[model samples]
Every structure is written in structure tokens, then in C-alpha cells.
Target: MRATSIILPALVTALFLPATSPALAQMAPPPVTDDVNLSLQVEDWVKAETARVILVVDLAGQAGGVNRADLLKTAAAIADRTDWRVIAMDKVSDSAGLDRWRAMLETRLPEGRLAGLAERAKRASKPGQQVRIAAVRFEPTLQEMEAARSALRVKLYARIKDEIALLQQTFPDRRYRVQSLRFNENSGGYRDAAPPPPPPFIPPPEIQMIGDPIRTEVIEEVAPANESGSGQEDKMIVQAMVSLGAFAGPTQ
Candidate 1:
């Protein structure tokens, strides 16, 4: 009866909700007959552990144009001959919109190696058919992504535990236990989806999502890494359901 009491008012209010409830329609009513609990969610950023640097090589020289076959051979040579582990990245694409092609190369690219790679590409260039480095971009490696996810989970767990501890301290008479937990992979943010995504928010004493039973994870976008690619972040969120019951300490 105590658990049902916690959700009854919400269901009643939902039923009385006016036509404007369509706006509220996105907010699903709380589940009745469920354990009474407090739901909390937390989000944090995780810096990537590794990065892959990409270099674009333009085969279209000033005079004629670098031959595709020769350029591929050059790519092989660059990978094999270079001390720096430069290797072909992906499929070739249109260079400047003509028969010419652009090649993408990848490398571990430790600090201070950019200059060496650029100089090597310049030396490979010629008047009629030149091949030179055009641009560079940073990409997170698979390992780095995994690392970020792990970091995010750890952070969220720590926050949830803190919140649970606070709740226990706040209401010494009730015994609280975690009922459920859900983690969001994509950064949590409001979106235009059917049934609608919850607004960007966090769990608090008074959560606004209007649901009675479950708490959704709160995910936020991570700051993008700058040019150097020294630091990259992938954020994550975890939602926790904590139910409480009367302590009924030592039967009198």
C-alpha cells in the first residue's frame, strides 16, 4: 500500500491532465504498483587515450597531374621506406574534381613528427605531376574510444553512489536500495523523436521528467578536441533507480 501510494497521485494527475497534455504527452506517466524509490542520473566527460592523425595528399600537380599508378607506388614506397609508420588510410577520392585523385594517409604521428612527414611529401612532388601533403585531421582510435567509455562509466557510478549516500543520510528512517541502473551510449540531450526524448537534465529531489518509476540517464555533449588533438572527450551518463522502505528499526 505504501508503494502504491507513491505512484497513485501521479497517475491521477496524468488522467486529469488537460488537452495541453499533448505537450506533456512526451512525458510518460510513472508506473503504478512499483517499488517506491528515488531515481538519479549523472553524466561526465572521458578523455580519449589515443589518437590517429590523417594526412591528405593531393596528386594533382601544377603542370600536368601525378599518375594514379605512380602515386599508388609512391604511397607503397612511403609506407615501406619511411621510418615514420606512414601508411595508406582509405579509398582514394576526387582531388580537385577532375581525373586527379586524392590519397589519405595515416600515422601514429608522435609529437614533432609532422614536419618530417611534410618534408618527405614535398620531396616526392614534381613540376608536371606533383604529390604533396594538403591537410591533416585528428581521429580517435578504437582503443581510445573504449578507454573513454570506461572512464565515463566509472565517473557516473561514483556520482550515483554519492547521491545514494546523501539520500540515506537525509532520510535516516528509510532504508534505500538500488533497484535498477541504465547507461546511455549516445550523449543525452533533448531530441525530436516519437514519444519525445527527455530534456537535458539531472536527477534531483524534484525531477521534472514527470515519470514516477524509472529515471533516464542524463548525457551531455563533450567538448571537441582542438587542432593538436592532445585531448579528446567522449561523454556518458548513468541513471540509477533507488527504492526505499520503512526502517522499522528494532521492534519495540
Candidate 2:
């Protein structure tokens, strides 16, 4: 009897398998869960006398039991700087809250001031070149919040420096300095500050020349009264600031 070689079924399968096969040995990795909720955008608007800084924040997709008030306090601390003013602050957790804030802002901000901002933005843009505002977005973890805060602090310092440079560059003839600006949270109160009592309207001085017989009417040029009227009442000034969560950044 002739001796014949016999191959087992397992041996036949192993012979067909690729030498570099991963499907046979590797287990799939688990799905990743993203918890970060954060975003940022540039908000530039000219205030009555200076550039104001404001923050509108939303902590969306974050875990429950987060201290929102503490977050606001932290934000206030970061924004409470002499270089910039936080004209308005709001924190929302849901879409309804966001809607409410938007409605409130729309009513509070002045239409005329917004128009003026539009004009300024138009004028600032070069004829052919467009002025692009700088904006950034991030989704940082709880641990990364501190890093984000540090980055924001650095940005604020840079903004102060840039504002000073802008003043100097724009007004070379007039000596200008960047002063510390304080924010007044009470919008109604800010508008109610009584205007300085108008300077006692002084009668123009009349000069009578006895020697000159020719009767010449002396037209006195009196300077116009300073308009003490402030900007629109309760106009919310938006500024460039960072968002705290993985929230969607504001669009242009």
C-alpha cells in the first residue's frame, strides 16, 4: 500500500491565511467619548470713548453638576482688567437660554450704534483688501480650562499693547495713551449720569473803538456748546473673548 500525506482542515485554513493578518489576533479598540465643549470668536465694536470687552458664554455638552456660577465668577475675574471693560455678561446652558439672551441683547443694543459700527467697519476696510477679524475655537477638557484661561490672559495683555500701538499710530500729532478702563454693569445707571451743567452762556465781549468813526459790526465767533449726550441707552458692547466649553463659536 502506497503511503499518502493527509492534511487536516485547520492546517489547510492556516496555509491560506495571510502572513501579516490582523483580523485573526487583534480586538477592536473601544469608542472614544468627547466631553469638551468650547468655542471662541472675535467681536469688535467701537464704544463711545474706547473699545469695550464683553463675554457671552454657553456651557453646552458639559457634564451635569458643574458650578456655573463659579464659572461666571472665574470669567469675571479674568475679564475684570483695567485695559478692557466687560460691557455685558451672560451665561446660558441651553438653546432657550441662548434665545432669551439674543432677544435681550437685540432690545438693549441701539440700532444707531450698530449702524455706526457698520459704517466704521466699511471705512476701515481697504478698497481692494478685506479686513478679516481674527477668531479661534477650541474644545478643551476640564483640565485644559486652566490652560485656556492662561492663553486668554496673554491675549488680553496683547490686546492692551495693540490698542496702545493703534492709538500712537493713528494719532501721531496728538499724544495718546492707553488708560485703564472700568466697566459699569448697570446700563440704566450709566445713561442716567446727569450731563454737566451747561457753561453759563457768556455774552460775547463787545469792543468799542472811539478812534475809528466807521461803524463796523464786530461779529464774535463763539465756540459751540459741547454735546454731553452719551451714546444710545443700554447699548450692549460685544468684545473678543473665549468660550468655556465645546460650544459652537459665534459666526460673523
Off-target runs (Cα >4 Å) in candidate 2 are: 1-143, 181-252
Candidate 2 has its poorest 10 consecutive residues by lDDT at 99-108
Please estimate how well model 1 matches the true structure, expressed as its whole-model Cα lDDT. 0.48
lDDT of 2 by residue, 137-247 (tens): 112233333444445445555665565466557655434333333321111223436677645443323211111133322212222111112432232222343211122
After superposition, the stretches of candidate 1 with alpha carbons farther than 4 Å from their true spots are: 1-51, 56-73, 76-101, 184-252
RMSD of candidate 1 to true structure, Å? 18.7
Tell me which residue pairs clash in candidate 2.
Answer: 37-245, 37-246, 38-245, 38-246, 38-247
TM-score, cand. 2: 0.18
- Report the Cα RMSD per candidate: 18.7, 29.9
Q: Using lDDT as the measure, which candidate wins?
A: 1
lDDT of 1 by residue, 122-232 (tens): 577665334444334344566655666677677766766776677679876565555666655654232234355546555443112221123322222122222244544
